[model samples]
Target: MSKLFLLVFIALSQRVQSFGIGSTLYCYQCVSTQPGCSPFNWFWHWSQACPEDGDTCVKVIERKGASEVVTRDCLSALKGVRTDIPADHYEGCKPAAVDVKLGNYVFSSIKELDVKKDYYDETTFCFCSFDNRCNGSSSLKVNKSVMFSLTALFMVIHFLILR
Candidate 1:
């Protein structure tokens, strides 16, 4: 009987080990109209662990005029959303139109551009990363060479003007 119990215990332990711990992702919880937390404001106190079914961290942004409404949450792999179509339909991404006007000189527009286009639906920004605490902050990529050249050009112009 003791040997049988030991075998059963070992089997259960192995099953638990396979599942493992730290399977949850971290997300932020805040609102755009909540007093001190306004317009993409986030606090450490609002961070939370994702649900058992969630495997990725997500940040959703919707732009309204000059302010943006942001929501950080956890996401599952198979989730879908509807946009510019009927219900029960899912398009991973959609094309959008953008208009730009610079003073009275240039007025230009772009039509049908492929944006992030994910299951998050029609949003200004929808980002997803597969890791714990990945959604804690906004991610940006900058080219070091471009930045360095711009800086050097500005310094050269400044020196010429001062001389």
Candidate 2:
């Protein structure tokens, strides 16, 4: 449908603009407690540049009682908390057992963080590197090559449908 195409187009366009030439990488900084943070809508509005020291973007989601809390920001923003990661990491969210509630935040970009020890029902963290606004909705982040391939495939499908 045209709707799907439009969505894809918009996403790709935003990605290109965000990750384009820039000194600091951009990320979607928000808290689920606030509007547009929950059910995270990854759009230009949420994109924010990370600090110069910020090398990664993070997203953490915590499920408490009847609601979920989400947090998204630069890895460096974790002031007092420490996030550990293996030398080898990739872009994507890996679910870890929750020791406590994490507000939707980033990782593999990290291995662990003792940010808070208050046990929660569930929590998930996602981390990504180098890309602007890389920490957005959909824990499964897409790479440039894949996005291009998808765009090409969709264009073909659209042309075929036109005929």
Candidate 3:
């Protein structure tokens, strides 16, 4: 019994030591309308390794007026910041989905991005995914929203033109 117990202890210790190697997550990043991060271009580029404390890759989009900011990085990537909401602190890559709406933007601090400009009713979307460079694809999900809105607008215009 004692020998078996010792073996189990050793196995547990080995697993603990190996944990360090698997902690990091790789993700892609790009600002608004960049040709480099487009779906076709992303695969050819290198990814950023998430910090040990960052578990999942995150894709965040914020639109204010005609200017939009898009960023892809590790979840909770921002550290040591004083904001209304504390930064999310995660330890390893995990799968998660979140959607929230707040004053033309979603999933981010209202104060972080200046809202003083002509606030066009915009929807901010934040997506998190696990696996290497997952954020790149997740960020593309935003395009779907844009496409849907455009399609609806086109139909409306067509109706008006026909009338």
Which candidate number would show the highest lDDT if scored against the true structure?
A: 2
Pick the TM-score winner. Answer: 2
lDDT of each: 0.45, 0.65, 0.50
Q: Which runs of model 2 end up more than 4 angstroms from their true locations? A: 1-18, 42-44, 81-90, 95-116, 139-163
lDDT of 1 by residue, 15-121 (tens): 43332335655556555455433334344336566665645555546554566655555554224531322222121222222223312353334323323232233
lDDT of 3 by residue, 1-163 (tens): 5456546755655544332246666677565467665333665556777765546665555555766666566655533421222234333322222223333543445754644322324433344543456666544333445545655675565557545
Candidate 3 has a TM-score of: 0.42
- How many clashes in each structure? 0, 19, 2
For model 2, residues 1-163, the per-residue Cα lDDT tens digits are: 6877678797876666455455777788888777767777665345777775546888877676987777888767753453432232357766644433454453333335434444456666788886666777656365668667777887787778754
TM-score of each: 0.38, 0.54, 0.42
Model 3: residues >4 Å from true position, as ranges? 1-21, 38-40, 65-67, 79-125, 138-163
In angstroms, the error of model 3 at 4 is: 36
lDDT of 3 at 115: 42
State the TM-score for model 2.
0.54
Locate the minimum summed-lDDT window of 10 residues in model 2: 79-88
Q: How does model 2 fare in lDDT?
A: 0.65
Pull out the clashing pairs in model 3. 55-92, 55-93
